[model samples]
Target: MKVFNEIETAKLLPMRELMEALRVAAQDCVEGKIVSPERMVVALKEGGIMLSMPATADDIAIHKLVNVNPRNSKEGLPTIHGQVVAMDALSGVMLFQVDGPTVTGRRTAAVSMLGISRLLAHQPKSVLIIGVGKQALNHVEAIAEIFPDAAIHMRGRSAHGAQMFVDQMKSVAPNLRVEEAGVDHDVVIAVTTARSPVYSELAKPGRLVIGVGAFTPEMCEIAPAIVDASTVYVDDPLGATHEAGDLIQANIDWSRVKSLASAFSEQPDFSRPIVFKTVGTGAWDLAACRVIKARL
Candidate 1:
């Protein structure tokens, strides 16, 4: 069995490769070539912590156990932390252990990008990202790799954090314009754990919005206005209904929401203001594990 730390995992799975793998995985899922059960969750306390268990299998099986503590901010620690275990499907032998948080951030960003690839028309010229945490950083890196020409706008709850992210990102993409904009962009990605809505307005007529925060009904990153203004799509029907705050808080008709699997499989009109909300799924982790194992 192999053990991969956070740094090692980052070195192994670059943003570009991860995004490509996730795109394939998403297609496989839409085509019913993979089996990914809905993620299971256990609340640790009232408004405190929780554990999410997600599993996925295709040629091999893997499970990711993630711990989420919203109160970790008081301790000056990350709110999300965990590890992933990959095992042989036929033999049931554990194969690898990788940093769960790293995988989560990478896979989540890649998954959002995968949805973007499927739903958007032309590649975006700029992307506005809300939040400056690990997931936000990963989103910037992934978007930069996938859409190199796109400018990046980062917004954080704290001005200091947003500026810091901008400074660090400029070193990586010197030619890439990084700014703190209000809401002008071709693509908008909300990755904060904000309990309230962070963005209310939709982008341009044909823009795309990807919401990665609010894995639970209690938290929401994008506001209700955005949900109302855009056509919505979800990775999983049950996952989105139970985990996404954007949909839950909006009081939008559940019947109007479309599943990505169905949309991709049936071929839907991609020329519209679209909102893709993902609570993250075990199937994605499984897909990522398959890629990692193959590379290994």
Candidate 2:
């Protein structure tokens, strides 16, 4: 069986193509052409979590195992690490194993961009990303790819870390701008693990808010008021209700919730602010697997 490490996987999964693949998968999931079991998570010490997500569609089967260690950054290690395994559904034969973190970082950012592409009426002129984690950096990369002309801004909890992040980003894109976290940006992406709201005044009208962190009920990154005010969309309805703290805490009307799949069919009203929250999904993992395999 073939094995691709983290670097190889990251190299294989290009952002634009991966985002499109996820868009296709999202449509398939809504059409009932795919089957993905709910992810299973186990609590670990020091506020960490380990999860297993498995899914099957057509002739392909895939599983992703991930670990989240909140304290890893203190030890100079990445907070997330994992692996993705692919198999032939009919023959039950193992096909390959790829680095989980690479697939996840790329796909998760792609998922958020997918939301932006489908829901937003226009390309953003300015973008604000709150948080400097792996996801945040990847989100910047994806945003840069999708909206090449947009000015990029970043904010993190620690001022020093935020500066460091900005410096690193400048090394890559010298013209990128760094700004304080605020409410007026055309696109706002919150990727922090803050238990409380990151920016309380994020209820600005017509802006696109992508909440990528705060997956559990105990963690709330986006303010409740923003969630309640916006026309909300999620990657998965059931997963959002159970796992998205921003949605659960806001007590959003589930009947009004729209899936990304529907965006593929028709565009929703973009006059009001749109909030897209995802708790991640196995179907996305499967979609990413297809991208990696095809590239190989």
Candidate 3:
């Protein structure tokens, strides 16, 4: 099998291309074209969990193994570590191996953008990103490409982490204003693992709020008020009911939450603010592999 490390995967899958692939995959998922099984999660003895996600889309098949360790930050390591193995559907031959964390970080951000893309009549003027982790960096890069003129704001629990993210952003985008996160923003993407709601209030309408973190029922990053104010959408209805902490803890009615496929298929009401929540899916990994293989 061809081993495409994190660096290679990053180089092959550009934001624009990856987002486009996700768009197609989202539609396929909505159309019931992709087969992605429920992720099997095993609890680790050291206060973390490991996930095995297997999926197939057309001729591409992928199995993504990921782990979440809350104690990793103390060890100067990433809180999450993952890898993806790509295989051929017809022959069941392993084709390539890539960094799971990188694919996931980029794919998750791109999926968020795909949802945001359908909701936008125009480009957002500003975006607020919660947490200065890898996911935040991916979103910043993707947003810079999609909404070039929009300002980027990053919020972290630690001032040092936030400042470092701001400095890094400034080096690549000097003219692009990177500031501390606040309520006065056009789009809000929360990627934190906070137990309490991260955003209590949104100051404006036409705002897009994305919750990519807080996957488990124990972690809650979105407030009940935010869910009440916005029209909620999820990547998958069934998965959301089980894994989406923001919606589950809030007791959100599954019937009320629209799927991403339905949102793209029909003309959704944009009168209220939009809250797009994703727990991440293997179909995206399969789609990402398709893009990666084509580029190579």
Candidate 4:
């Protein structure tokens, strides 16, 4: 069986490649070419911690298991951690094990970028990133690579954390401006698990917003105003409706929002502000793993 570490997996999964793979996966999802069970979740505390299991399969028919937790920072550990086990489609033999933490970070950002590519009007000139963690840093790297001319604005709960994120990213893209300020940008990406809203009034009309945070009903990072002001898109209707607090708390009619599958199927008008929310799915993990394996 093949085993992959974080750095090895990172090298195998680049943002542009992952985004292309996810685009194909999204089309398959819309055409009913994939089977993805609704993600299963278990709450650990009243509303503080939770565990999730999401799985998927492809032409090779190997199924992958991804275990994820969104509350581990307090213990000085990664908030998301787990392993991906690839199994034979017929005999169900374990074929390989890959680091889920690395897969999750890469795929999550790829999925968001996939949505952005399909739904947004034009490439963004600047990006506003909320929360300064692994996801945030990975997102900056991914978005910067995709949109080389765009500047990145990072914000975190602590000034030091925000500054650290800026410094680390500056090393990679020295010409890129990394600041700790709240300003409207062409794109806004939120990846925190904050229970309360983080940036409510920062969204401007005609901007693209991506919410990768708050996979549970009680957690939300983007403000309700953002939801109310933008046209909403979701990766999975059932998953986002049940887990995305930004949509749940806004009390928006679910019928008004379009799923990524349907959005690509119908080719809707995206002339106004838009919001894309994802609770993360197993199909994405499988899609990413398949792409990484092929590259290796």
| Candidate 4 residue lDDT tens string, 53-162 | 44545453434444445555667877666677666556766667788778889888888777767777778777778888888878877877777777778778877788
TM-score of every candidate: 0.90, 0.96, 0.95, 0.90
Cα lDDT tens digits for candidate 1, 1-296:
89999998777676667766766676777677767777767767646554555565557778788888778877899878888999888788999999999988888888787777778887887787888887887888787778778788877877777788888888665434445546457788889888898878744567888888887888888878888878899977767877888899989799999887665566656555789898877777877787788789
Instruction: Kindly indicate the candidate among 1 and 3 with the higher TM-score.
Output: 3
Stretches of candidate 4 exceeding 4 Å from the true structure:
45-54, 61-71, 175-183, 265-268
Worst 10 residues of 3 by lDDT: 174-183
Residue range 222-270, candidate 2, lDDT tens digits: 9999988899999987788889998888888899998888888877888
Compare candidates 1 and 2 on TM-score and give the better one.
Answer: 2
> Per-residue lDDT tens digits of candidate 3, residues 1-296?
98977899888788888988888887887777889988898999687999999998777889999999888888899988888999998898999999988999998988888877886546777788888887888888888877778888877887677888888887654434445534367788899888899877752468888899888888888898888778888986767888999988888877789988787678777777888899988988888998998987
Compared to the true structure, candidate 2 yields what TM-score? Answer: 0.96
Ranking by lDDT: 2, 3, 1, 4
Q: Compare candidates 2 and 4 on TM-score and give the better one.
A: 2
Ranking by TM-score: 2, 3, 1, 4
lDDT against the true structure, per candidate, is 0.78, 0.85, 0.83, 0.75
Candidate 4 accuracy as lDDT: 0.75
